[model samples]
Target: MTNTHIKTLTAAILFVPLLAFAAAPGSTDSIETRHGRVDVIADADATHLLVAGKKIATLGVGSASLFRITSAAEREYIIVQGSRPGLHCHYSYRLLALSDSGPKVSKEFGECLDLGGAGMSGAEPVVHLNSRVDPEAGVETYQWQGDDVNLVFESPTLCGATGFVAQKNAAPVRAPLASRVKGSGRLQFLSAPDAGCAMPGVFVVPGDKVTATLASAAFVYASYTNPKSGRKVQGWVPRERLSDL
Candidate 1:
């Protein structure tokens, strides 16, 4: 055999193993061969990044193919990494495994429909707010679980306020509505008086943080009311106590 042929064959044998070894530690092709068939496949129909069949990160890819295996907290993740040398820019993908599990555990307003049989008045999933206000303490709220909660609290009072579960990155993670909403919408805010801030209740669905704009535009309206502020008013309720809201 020609020297060139021998050199090429040697390079091929060495390179192939190195590539598969980097896929995942203790998951080398050689190791897998010692066990059984290696299942690394790229499902083109899938919405994720995959290298040699294992899913990697998948967020965005612009004709540039780059993916890696990143480790985190004893977990192995197929990570996607890409950069344009000519364009001098980089990109990444947020690839994920499609679950064979049924449509995620969904929650509906029907579950939280009656606020667990709580006497919440006004339109279902909606309450009417006249020019008046509720003098009693505790604010109005609705929810099934943290995951599927669609809370909206607002007051027209100069002390007018608004609150609800604010959503962060709407990554569709496989989880029950309750578990998914943890650490989400934990914060609260109040609208400037001039903004006529209307906190509308939301019709939330599990795994639906996407297509959801927690921005100024996504503000739902619970109802409309007017709390004469500049003018005289009843004694103030302590901030700690929501008696005035």
Candidate 2:
């Protein structure tokens, strides 16, 4: 063969093996866990969950995406997000725990766009998932408890702007006996503590006097007495909208 042809042939030989061993597009690498490596293998028909090369579970029939893998002292937790066939916007997640018997579903949360990101909060790792269609469904927060995942908190706001759970269990403190609405516009008084709930037509405008009794992370339970009707309306209002008088 000519030297030019020989060099091209040699290069082709070197490249063939690299192609054979190359990772396929859309294939995810194995993730290390406390037990072993975990993998999500997808095909045209189904998506499979594997541990140490052994098939553990079938995640779904369509698309499945790995959200997170968290390890604790006893076991490893895997969060997988998937959508139903033909419903791209409707998504859900499954929490799987790795055990000696195999990997098993710990918990399942449905009807979310995409579960919020996972991260560390102090010493504990936590995951937050937000609702896709229902704003009132709010956000669900989870944390690892040994091998199992626990839903520790649920926020009333879409962005999870509340720390109510942390303050929920704390010793009760004295709040201002009375306060006045301080915002420029009318503040919605929700029937429930959640801001996402439909307004019941109850509203408090600036300079309106209200009594603050109970308080949550982002809202406060207020009793407002209408001066004209002499009627008392009790509901939850945004905490920031009230000022101590």
TM-score of each: 0.20, 0.47
Global Cα lDDT for candidate 1: 0.22
Best by TM-score: 2
Candidate 2, residue 110: Cα displacement in angstroms equals 2.2
Lowest summed-lDDT stretch of 10 residues in model 1?
A: 6-15
Query: TM-score of the candidate numbered 1?
Result: 0.20
Runs with alpha carbons beyond 4 Å of true place in candidate 2: 1-29, 69-72, 99-102, 119-126, 132-137, 142-153, 158-162, 165-245
Candidate lDDT (C-alpha), each: 0.22, 0.56
User: lDDT per residue, candidate 2, 1-245, as tens digits?
Assistant: 11111011110001011001111225654566777877776676677777788887776546566544333435455566665666656666666666676677656564544554453333344556665455556667676565556788776642232233323322222965788889798888765455443356889899989887766556676788899999888766777888862
lDDT value, candidate 2, whole model: 0.56
